[model samples]
Target: IPDDLLEAARIDGASEFRIFGSIVLPALKPIIVTLAVFTLLGTWNDFMWPLIVLTDKDLYTLPVALAALSREHVQDDELMMAGSVVTIVPVLLVFLSLQRYYLQGLLAGSVKG
Candidate 1:
């Protein structure tokens, strides 16, 4: 919807932000919340990619931090366990908040008349 609308707007000579404001974003709100939750969980639990990309402590994503903690501090380390908990909390929060729409979208996509 957004891309098609943007294409139509471009042909009509609408400015970039104007196209987005008028045609793209309004049509996106229905699915935006669900996509945002998925994005949050995916980024929060991302491990090796972040481990490979993030070298600095301040930039450490929770999954990579948890992996590093478990390896150096022992598998049973309290800090590692805490890191695991921290890594999962966002997923739980996002899932709890968005599960209704997620399930709704899933059902809608999977069902046919």
Candidate 2:
């Protein structure tokens, strides 16, 4: 955030909350979205930790479930492909939903004032 902008807002009699809401939050949107996407992708595709931690077959995550499905149906290529597609679709939807903000974050300027 720019100190000069906040100082200017103060000079204009804008309250702290107003300054934060009007300025800080908008400036942070791209960063927040980027972080959210990264975290989501990390957790969504995670396999090993969930597989090791969960004992119940019913509590498995998509990747672990997919792995088990593969093991059970080793001869079924079509079923394995279908399982993979189902696992990927939700993440793709999330990325497309936030694509604008994520791209903005990637292309944001780094120039210092």
Highest-lDDT candidate: 2
TM-score list, all predictions: 0.54, 0.76
Please, what are the lDDT tens digits per residue for candidate 1 over residues 16-51? 999778665655554887678768767767778878
Candidate 2: tens digits of C-alpha lDDT, residues 22-59: 87777788888879989999999899999999999999
CA shift of 27, model 2, Å: 0.9
Let me know the TM-score candidate 1 reaches against the reference structure. Answer: 0.54
Show model 1 residue runs off by greater than 4 Å: 1-32, 102-113
TM-score of 2: 0.76
Query: Backbone clashes in each candidate structure, one number apiece?
Result: 0, 0
